[model samples]
Target: MDTKISVVENGALKRVGKVFAEAFGQTPALLVADGNTLKAGGFETLRSLKEAGIVVRQYIFPSNPQPYADEYAIQIVHETLKQDNSIAVVLGSGTLNDITKRASSELDRPYMVVATAPSVDGYTSYGAAVSIGGFKQTLPCAAPLVVLADTKVLCKAPTDMTASGFGDCMAKFTAGMDWILADLLGVHPIRKDVWDMVQTPLRKVYKKRSSIARREASAIGILFDALSASGFAMQIMHDSRPASGAEHLISHVWEMEHLSKDGLPVSHGFKVAVGTMTIRYLYDQLKMVDINSISLIGGESWADRERAVRSFFKDPKVAEQTVVIAKKKFLEGEALSKRRETLLSIFPTLIKRIDEQLPPYAELKEAMRMNGAPVSPEDIASNLEGLRHAVTGAQMIRDRYTVLDLFYELGIFDQALESLQLM
Candidate 1:
């Protein structure tokens, strides 16, 4: 709702300056981009701003290692922006936008984005995903004031980028299911409007996999729209509950571990795509779970959980902080007993909801294949060992009640890990 203008037109870049002038009244702008994104639309973006009589400054990152949205990169942008009062105009996808978003928020200035690819849904989201102190976290930030994209540019983006966008979009299936699970478990309830805002557009995008793979303009536009819609949903909820879930947590673990291929960190969506498949597989396995045979862990003592957190994080400070967060949601004693009882009572309903909310695992895999998104850990250079570690670490790192937590609570985490190995 805070995003005032969103354009996905054919030559949106050509009119960006005019649009900005009309919306914000010719404010001085700080155009941010990287070497790659600069080559994509830098000249035109500058020319457009100039034509509209807007003074603009440029901050372009070199392509060699690329600009990571890490603490160092954020500080660089923050320091530069602090020297002036120019409004930030980020001209890239994902990381660049996240960096600018956080930097602008630190300065208490509104920023705009001109998307070069439909590679992520962070464009209009209210948090910047950054790696700081060796921990990957989402730093709260303001949503972009305006989001503009040229369908022509998005359609011509590298195939992997578009596929990554699709993968991120597809993650909504699991994210939605996780929210529903959390709601039923009394963790977090779903808001009808927010759920509809993200899920409705997602269904349409999912049906256009082939069109997206072929780079059809209409399909690409739809993908972009869905991605933006996801961002808006997150903004409205003031959290990523509606847009991220177990899959995203898995991605964060891989990110912190520096999982990479060809000496470059894996793309966020690609990691998430594999994670989506893994989570989907876990759900499939859950279908065959005989609740009668499974036994719940009575409850973990705070000391035991703290020790687990410490071991998982390997950093005393981070583990301490994690325990504090975990304490907020960790159940024990009567609460745990009640949770178990409630879970058993709703088992049938939960199964029904899972069946209704998730697409078949094979169907999801085929969709990824159709769109060229990774469908397995191997595709992203991750192994079962690393993935198993990620699954465990994911639950420890977040207090969110996802399927990982469900299995852990049910004392079947080892079984789930084994299933992942076999898969």
Candidate 2:
């Protein structure tokens, strides 16, 4: 894993000048931020850096939410890099962090983040999910050298954004469970060390949910630690399988469709939160039915059960994806026997370990309420149609082996879809 130095003290930012001076040895830093964050704390951060005798250059974009982390925004940072050899520092959350992460990777320079909100997990992750040519994808990037979050700033963030973060964090429960399933099926290898590292801070933070909402030092510190550890997990594994799963894909669909409510786009975490519920509902329904008996009720009406995806997708594409996955499993039956058995042997242990780390959805929601996070799918999407569309969208991209793929291969997708209507 890349060396991650996280400094997130309440008044620690005031000492940023001294910190930067000590770490960089006179090397200058390019401060990247958008208007909202500039107004929020960019000036103070800059002043502190200069006060510590560190030379600095600053870039600020207008406050419009749309002017963030697109190819155009990244271009400006890329072009600015031509003028100097300075490490980059993002003074905002979400887009600012993503753009800087991508830009710094392109420049082959280390970057750090001064997080102004707890809006998303891309903060410390090694890969950045961005929209390129109107398609949503996760592109390779380097993790930040340091991650600093001021709880004061995080607590002051817009309530919806905080809710989005809560939603994203909660999705980890279902996502982690799916990871266990994939391990059982022998589709992928699970990294026990990485899993434990990211999970430790998660346990501490979840237990202190009210403190996070109140911006208590210890609680915010734990959240920040877990977030950073998550980034490191991706850095070490070189994949997001340990972190994001189908829930993130659902969010991507919303991004591609440009869905919004009340004239504003919903945050990524918010979309995933609802997707989490939808997936759990699917599992809950499954516990009451027999997987083998599924097709008898609904014919394998999905598309061909031998392919990975459908280039032309609509709301019911999940059904098609399911049939395709099911056929693949049928073919792999003989070869995957040992692997499946190994996964089964370890799955119970994985679930037990995960429970020790992250909170369940119900408990997670209570934590969110305490931390000022949002509570429902309606809270993230503009309307019900948008939510369903995003969930369907998630099915199309990333042939990543996930629980969604598992049910699809098992020909039980229709069951998952029908369950969504109840939510």
Candidate 3:
């Protein structure tokens, strides 16, 4: 909601000066970018700002290792920005933008992003996915004051990056399904306007898979729009429930484990793409489940659940924190039994919703394939065993009510895990 301006144009980079001047009015700006983004839009961005008579400073991250949105990275940027009164202007995708967002928030200042790729929807969202002490978490922050994207730059991004963006956008299918499920269970109801904002454009982009794969400007612009809309949806909800669900949880598990290739962590979209496939597959399997056979296995005792959380996290401090967070949502005994009854009572409707909300698993895979996005675990350098582990870890880490929670509650999680075949 804090984001006041949103620009998507063929030559948006050239409007950096006018837009920045209009918003902040001659305030010195701190331009943040990695070496790659700096090369891509730095010159033009700087020229535009100077032409508008805006004083600007540049903070370029080295490209070799690629900057991460981790505590160390946040600290470095925060330290640098604290020295000046410059408004932050991030000029990259996920990580750089997250770094700037968190740092600016710490300084009680707002920032803007000049998105180089449609990579992820964190740009206008008021949270930063950052790792501290090796644990991944979405730290609260201010949404960008402006989100500017140039289709010309976006279309030229690496095919995998754009495809990754498509994958992230596509995950909205399952995200929406999860929200609907939560709504049904009285966990969190959907906001109709936010739902329409995210879901409508999502369907449009999903239909343009080939165009996105071909790097067409129009298609890429739509992808950016949908991604930004997703951020706005999250903003409206004041939480990620509207935009992230089980798929993102899987990505979070992978992040905690540092899943990587060629010494670099996998992109968020690539991980979520595979997560989307996994969740869709689970939903497909859900169709075959016999609700009558889903006997109530009493929920784990809090002490036992706490132990599992501690063991799963492998960090005493983090495990302690997780237990405190989990305590609120961890059900037991009569509560668990009643929950099972409620789930049983709603089983038919739940199935109908799943059927209505999800595309066929094969169809979803085809869409991902059409966009050159990774459609399987192996494509993202992960295997079923590893993903199963991630899925388990994901369920334990977050108390959010997702399909994963439903499956876990019903004692069908292991069965569903075993059902996954090589894709």
Candidate 4:
């Protein structure tokens, strides 16, 4: 909602200087980018801004180790901006955008982004998902004042980055279903407007899988638009519930643990892609479950859950912090009974809604495969056992009411894991 101007088209980058000049009247700007994105759109953006008579400075990060949105990165950007009055113009996808978003917010100045890739939905979202200390969390920040995404630039992005965007876009399917579960159970109700804003455009992007795989410009533009729509939905709702669910939590677990493959950190979209498939499979299994035949049982005690949380999070600070979160959602005795009863009573409706909400697992898998997104945990440098651990660990780290919490509260957490047979 904070984004005043958004242009997604071929050659939109050409308008960067004019747009920024119109908005800020030739305000001096800081162009933040890493080595890769700097090559992608940095020079063009710089030229465009200067042509419009805007003075500019550059903060080019070395791309070798690849920058991540952590506190250290934020401090550098914040200090850089603190030394001058220049507003920022970020030139990358997720990490650079997040770093600049947080730093700009800390400085109480607006910023813009020239997207080199359609790699994430955070471009128009109100919060920066960054690692503070060792824990990954969403830090409150303002959205960009303007977003300029060039399809030409986007179509040239590494195939994996586009695949990552596809994965993140595809995640909306399971994310929506998770919201349906929470809505139906009367825990968190759905907002139809925000739902339509995100889900409506999601289907259009999913239909362009083959085109996206070929790096077709129009389809890639559509994907960029859809990703931005999700961000706008988040901005409007001030919550990620409309765009993220258990799948994101799964990714969050890997993020906190710094999951990596082949010596490089895994991309967020790739991790979420795997999490999307896992959640869909879990939904598939849930469909076959006979709620009536299952007996309600007691859940873990708060002390036991606290111990598990502390044991799972190796970082003492993260563990100490997560123990409090774990306690907030731990259910037992009558509280657990009421939740299970509500689930049983609504089991038929839940299944029906899930059927209507989620696409067939095979169809979903093939779509992701077409986009070159990860279809399995191994594809993201994670194994089934690691995934299972992440799924359960996900519930403890966030108080978000998701299907993961549902299974735990229903006293069938281990049973669900056993059914998955992640081995």
The candidate maximizing TM-score is 4
Span of ten consecutive residues with least summed lDDT in model 4: 414-423
Better of 2 and 3 by TM-score: 3
- Steric clash pairs (candidate 2): 163-374, 184-343, 303-320, 305-323, 305-324, 322-408, 325-409, 326-409
Show pairs that collide, candidate 4: none
Error of 2 at 250 (Å): 2.1
Model 3, residue 125: displacement in angstroms?
1.2
TM per candidate comes to 0.94, 0.83, 0.94, 0.95
Please identify model 3 stretches exceeding 4 Å from their true place. 296-304
The TM-score obtained by model 2 is: 0.83
lDDT of 2 by residue, 210-252 (tens): 7777666566666666766667777888877777887777776
Q: How accurate locally, in lDDT, is each candidate?
A: 0.87, 0.67, 0.87, 0.89
Clashes of 4: 0
Q: In terms of lDDT, which candidate is strongest?
A: 4
What is candidate 1's TM-score against the reference?
A: 0.94
**Which parts of model 2 are misplaced by more than 4 Å?**
291-362, 365-375, 382-389
